[model samples]
Target: MKRYICFIALLAGMVACKKDTVRKGNDPYRETVVPAIYINKDGISPTRARVGEEVMISGKGFEKNKDKLAILFNGVKAAIISLTDTTVRVKVPAQAATGNVAAQVDQQYFFGPFFRVTGVFEMDTLYPSLVGANGAINNIIPVEDGKYLVVGDFTDYGNSGKKDKLNRVARINHDGTVDGTFGPDAKNGTNSTVASAVALPQSVNGYQYLVAGSFNNYEGVSYVNSVALLNNNGSLAANRIQSPNGKDITVSALKGGVSGSVNNMHVQPNDGKILLTGNFRFYVQPNFNLKTVGTDLDSVHLDSIQVNGLIRLMPDGGIDSTYNYDLAKHMGKEGANGFIYRSLLLPDGKLLIAGSFTKYNGQAVNRLARLNADGSLDASFMPGAGADQAIGNMERQPDGKIILTGSFNMYGGVKVPHIVRINENGTIDPGFNAGEGTDGFINNVGIMPGGQIILSGVFTQFNKLQRNNMIVLNADGSVHATYNSFGGFSAVGDNGANGNVNTVSRVIPQAGEKSLLVVGSFTKFDFRTANRIVRITYP
Candidate 1:
């Protein structure tokens, strides 16, 4: 009986030893814990991107085994460029649509918010015939009702296959087609050149457009050298609008030849007074006769005749003498005179003017100056030494900061490349630094809805970064690292023998949309065939 009991105890000890061996051979903690494959909270760096653009997907538990990991954009498989335990870089697939981005690690799956795949440009059709090889779209203004007013040296528009005459000015529909309702016959609208056109906030006798250029006649009317008002139908407003001196505000070359034109115009938001600035001297009416005056010119007459480069006028074309800044007296020396290229009206009833001037009202102001509401130079606001060169353009930020760009190399005493920001007090904002700004001239500066700045010109590089003729900047003045899809502008032939010099003349951002109207002299962008005008979309 004792032998049998000892045998039973040994059997129990053997069972216990077997259990310990199994536990030692297989540890519960040693089991491979497949990390919870997922995406980071910030799904992608650029929420909007195009095909062939690289986007990063970040999440926890992304294993290094790329073979077992996969990225899908809108359910379309994307090419994974690199993969790590925490991040995954993938290129947008061509078949990808605007939808949620997902990842698959072996059998486990992770998803993110909808990633928007926006088109590279807004307008799909290209208006190749609008601009000649040498011509360009100078300005494009977005109308209140989803239309656009385009003015430039072009002579035609429409598709290259079937073109139509467009003169120097024409209204374009939202789809980029010529508006036949505007201008007569869509062929010979304006007789001569039209430099700038503005839509009046308050219509005058049913006229809403004020076009100024080197045109002498519109709809067969004579003695109209520079300015003309257009009716809603795009024809010459039946009621004639005359300049202050009963003569058109003639534009002349800075060197000394008379050719009536207007560089820019600003309409007051509060009172509808029009502010005109350009190169003009005396406002003279050459042939004035009261008896032979036509019905259009009967009511309009000269109130104050002596006007210089800048002048303000009433809605009825009468001179507003209440606010006068003697542009001639404040302009620079005798030979090299100052020219106002741009102006801005501040919310505080102040005016900021910039150009190629070294003094303002004999105050030794540099290229920029500020004026009070009464047209007196603002003594408190001053930019010491101003810019080294002419300020081509200026854009006011939402925060009241001013962005000035041009062919300048420095502002005040600091090295500020071609772009600089100034505070409301006219002092430089040191925090806004554009390191080694654009290498070439900056023609236009536009602000995006997202506060990013879009600049275009003859620049080949910006802030030591390689960006062709155009670039976008963050609100803090840093180059957008992910915005580099434009392959840069290049001349077609040797030394630009084809008459295209690769220039971007204007950039207008569409309100309430992530798109831009880019007009330039280039026939290509991002290595693709594009005309002088194209719409660029931002993600």
Candidate 2:
């Protein structure tokens, strides 16, 4: 697929600035401003513009006279056609070119007066980087080719002798170290940038791509909800993008839905646009009264909040507003204390969102919810009417059934925990039922190619034996003993440098590969080699 990205920009007054410069070289002249993101519209499909058509895209950091802005057909630079206040007119070139369609810029600045820009570069394929420091490297994810992008939240501001203070992203070297590539001493301080990412690269439309999400700060608050990118190492590739005007955190949340805590992210079924789920809320109150109205609360200054139970993004850096119609919205128990922690997108395009909401779409639901393609509640498919437990991981199996794992004890009328099979209508599929599954919680779930189910979380007694933090379940929700500890991938290691990892957010299971990719907050897989990440394979 064609490689593309958005650019960093300002809005309204944010775009208003004053600068003076003396032109020297052939570089176009204009006022300089920092961009938040970069963009390229290649191979993305049904784009806002076509091959021969023309369109005007206005964004931050733009100048008409100084920046020699040009357009391209498929990356071919057009001739010096025309220019204006905020828009540039040029014929699309016929072929592909490595250089720019125009030079968008400023006359002078610390880096340079003007910056020449070009269309998005198409990347056919690229290997993804596996990034984790046990819990030592909080939110920094390693992108492909030795670049470290900051997921933010790292209290350690100075590292590699960089004391200028840093944001959340930076560039590192191939030796698992910081790269001094973009700036002189680029040290992104804590909270300056933030993102939640994994190391696995995915193939899309026959081309390879990277997936990431964030909780950026649009407001001056601690974490205002945002996400960005870098290659493989830590570096600034683009400006951060904010969520829809209000959405910050999701459906059901752990706590009462904080300001910016998007604990996890996901990908959509058909078009891999990227889905983010954590916890979102509309208002915050002190006492634990979800319906505390007309009780002096109206006069008090309350925090108006919005938790993003789920959201979709466009490749060209726009929010898929249409998705809000297809996904869950204004859901939860119709009070201040409702939210969504995680989700599972099914093969049939339906969504299974789990967290702590007691109602969905004005209907009575427990902690789990089933939504249609257009974001309305699935009234027929109901789960927790009696055994109301939270669903941590929901994955479909080969036999066309869903294996749900989480910290739940009862669902409907049966006793199930750690694992259960739910039919398409959200009822327990009696054909694949086991009395009571696990004695503890299952943070994540995956189906191995060999038909075994991999489970991870804070469990000590999985079947009858003593399991560490992970266990395997068979097709019928019983323990799969064959691959119990079959691989030495998770042994034991020193975790003094790492912190406590609470949840196993995701599990990547492939059919042919001998192992599966596991992710969580734990410092080690089990005890193996400081393994914040490890591949579980058979002997």
Candidate 3:
């Protein structure tokens, strides 16, 4: 009787084990092991694969239940082409993005190596593979050869274990490698952020860079405030004049470099004068009033004049009195009601200024105004009603039409989304129809020789099509379906909680190439890690 009872007990235990196996197989959400807690023993073959391509994943337990196993690439489910005891071949899904590959068995995931998605508009892998800037890159100016100068608030560039402490300025080659020879002496590129930059015409000593922002100094050179000139090697450029004390004092900045932040800087044609605009109350200069002062030598005092957000400087860092010295006399004490974001120099010497201000020199310009060469508001180039919001950027076409982009949904009272074209006289150009336009504000625009427009900013859709943060539009303002259908930029929290957190601040087309040099605060492009800068090419 005892032997028979022991036999029955053993049979009952076997039945219970069989039942557990069946239950676990049917429970899709039940995990015998913890989910998302990865064991790093296995990896995927080929590391990177394009959409619809087959990749082999190597790991144990994949063959435990081949029909029940679920393979995924970056959360997108992939189709299993074949399976074995220690390997599984799966095809990447069309919607699969660049991320880790995972295999799920009984609801527990085994993570594999990070996989990159490739195709058109993908990040140029030939470029530096390091994680990009530690902060936002506000501006990029093309320099000699295929290199470019980039400036922003960042103090470091590159990934961990390999980084360059470049401060706010850095020069990069065509392949995106930092030029160590350019700024070897500037341990710290700038004391603060650099907002705008323009390259001066190549002189006998290479290229001079005019940089403006909130920085008060470059390296140890002080009192630069918001503007200064940098030499080819990224050092603060000094004038040839000697100080009153007979010592050769290096003075690279204007007396006090205006009084506040400079958002835009431009070099005039034929003349090397620097034109700057931003939010400032005055431009300060060294006052030589009463140099001897009876007996004791007078200490150099700074003299500040209320000029209100617009000024021009000679190449020698002195105020260009001939341009707008009496600007207050013409435009009142409040030159612009708000900040001037950008200034475009025209061939005819007139200037197109755009910004947040609704009034210029007390005239109701409404965020878009044309200034005569003398700096007074041009009343004839009237933009009736103008932009209802701030104009962030401007682009001039070969046909002389001005393209304006901003946060405004209406231009001159017409519902024209975030972008519009205007005639030379500031009247709206109806030829460019943006349909519903971009869903968000546009930061900048790059016009191609073929009339195609490249736009980038805080947007996900153009004309109701999914274009992400960047898009190419036909001249008539229709989406370039073929170019945008396959691949484009993507961002974190797109169309969700984080609104416009990631942006493409600028898109510059290579002078004679099909590639675009893109820079901004973005962290991704085409679902891959691109950091703040990327060079993407279209087919």
Candidate 4:
């Protein structure tokens, strides 16, 4: 009986020691010594400073030996002019950039607040100082002779002195001044929104534009449907005829247009035909009684046919009869169908489209698919399950591979966060890996001449690294280190104070590839007020 009692006590003691071991293993102080260089939460003074300037840092526990103390401005070491236990004076390094500041003492380090490095990749102050369009600028297309055509929902551009009361469309010169030679005022522009504008190729129409949106009228003429062709001076393309009284009258010649909004427009390079994609359902055609009114059409009579979010139009804005619309409309169900958000025209006359689609032409295509020249689904290119979510944008590489970005975390059942690369055969590329992908959504992507990629959206980090809304990825899908020096876009405060949150809708490389034109709903980029549009130049 005594031996049994002894064994019980011995076992209890062993269990007690085991618990003690775990307690010691988790001791917070075991591996932690007070950080030798203690920097307060807001230790850096003047938060923003230029290179070759001096800034003061306040901290405690700094090293007593000057040689053992170091100050780093965003990973770039700065020269310490003087140092003490409580304060240190330092000169910003030439390579210092916009990021967190840190102090190092021996092997321990302490971090400080973020510092904005000015005079590097900054906003073009030469851009018109007056406030830009009152609303968002949706699209910026570079036109002839260093001019840009900007289209959006804005009602006014610039201040009262230089402001133009334009409705949705305007031309800005290379120096950021509104070109008064473009069109009339707001009273004569499109009645509603102009969502997209594509320049018609010279083969189709000389120096003309194909604008599409929800507007039903342009220049007070009601015959223009959701799509219209505009002349070089931004007026609706019309035909002038002489009446019986010998007076010339202009009438719209575009008889048929789509009934729904066109989100994107593409002019085919091989042919002058226009390719449109959006959430539309019908192609509208109007029967005009020229005998009743020589200058206008009878608005009461119209004709419409079923369409499934994709259509092709000839140079005259008439539906293309040669293309097969029957095969394109078989999108799983009669009423319920998928909608395409964007499409890319391949060099071989094929089309690549991505959106929230689950099937195409009665076959399960997930969200991405390829179409033959005649609008039939290409069975050869197959993405087993495709993207698990919506693909916002896609860009083709020079080598025939494609880069896609969206709100998806998986592609074809594989974990490939917000972005992925697919081969021409519709298989995920094994060579390009975006490690863990981005933490937030990527809305736009642009591939540079050397294969580097530019991604913009509402993301704060990419691949677990701290990059603001914009980041440049190498050819193999790794973050470009040189892009780090140029700070990205972000809001001002902790909760995006002053309504300054950044969202890049599109990023297009300029002609020389030496700069990028970034357009979005942003009020700030790199801690500067950019007002929705900014040009980032590379030296």
Query: When superposed on Cα atoms, how far off is each prediction in RMSD?
Result: 20.7, 30.3, 11.1, 9.2
Top model by lDDT, which number? Answer: 3
Q: Which ten residues in a row have the lowest lDDT in candidate 1?
A: 250-259
Alpha carbon lDDT of each predicted model: 0.67, 0.45, 0.75, 0.74
lDDT of 3 by residue, 195-219 (tens): 8888888889788888899877677
- Which lDDT value does model 3 have at 236? 78
Worst 10 residues of 2 by lDDT: 120-129
Clashes of 2: 93
In angstroms, give how far residue 506 of model 3 lies from its true place. Answer: 1.6
lDDT of 1 by residue, 1-539 (tens): 99999999999999999988897796767788655676777668788788889988887666655777778875568898887787888998764545578887777777886576655433334534233323456677877578888777766655322234566667777767667677666334467666677887645355377777666666666555466666666666543334544754322111111134567776777887766666665343323334235554433232235455666666655556566644555422221148878888788877788889777656677888887776667989968778988998999988989999988888888888789999988889997877777777777787877788877777656765445577778888887655644454433554645332436767777777777777766776654456567767666
Using Cα atoms with residue i matched to residue i, what is each candidate's TM-score against the true structure?
0.67, 0.52, 0.73, 0.78
lDDT of 4 at 419: 90
What is candidate 2's lDDT per residue for 1-539, written digit by digit as tens?
22322223433334344222223334564567655222333311222332334434333233433343444422334554444444444443323222223333333211211112222211111212133332333334445554444333333222445554334444444333445453335334334324355443543322222323344332222222344332323332332322333323211111122334454555554665555566543323222223335543312133433434555544433345565432255322232125666666777776777766676655777777777765567777767482366666577777666777667777776776546778877788876755455566666677777677777666555544445556666776676534453211132326545332344545554334454545445444433343233445453
In model 4, the runs with Cα more than 4 Å from the true position are: 1-56, 60-83, 88-114, 118-122, 158-164, 203-206, 240-251, 290-299, 327-336, 490-502
Please give the lDDT score at residue 202 for candidate 2.
Answer: 40
Output the better candidate (2/4) by TM-score. 4
How many backbone overlaps does candidate 4 show?
0
Say which prediction, candidate 3 or candidate 4, comes out ahead on TM-score. 4
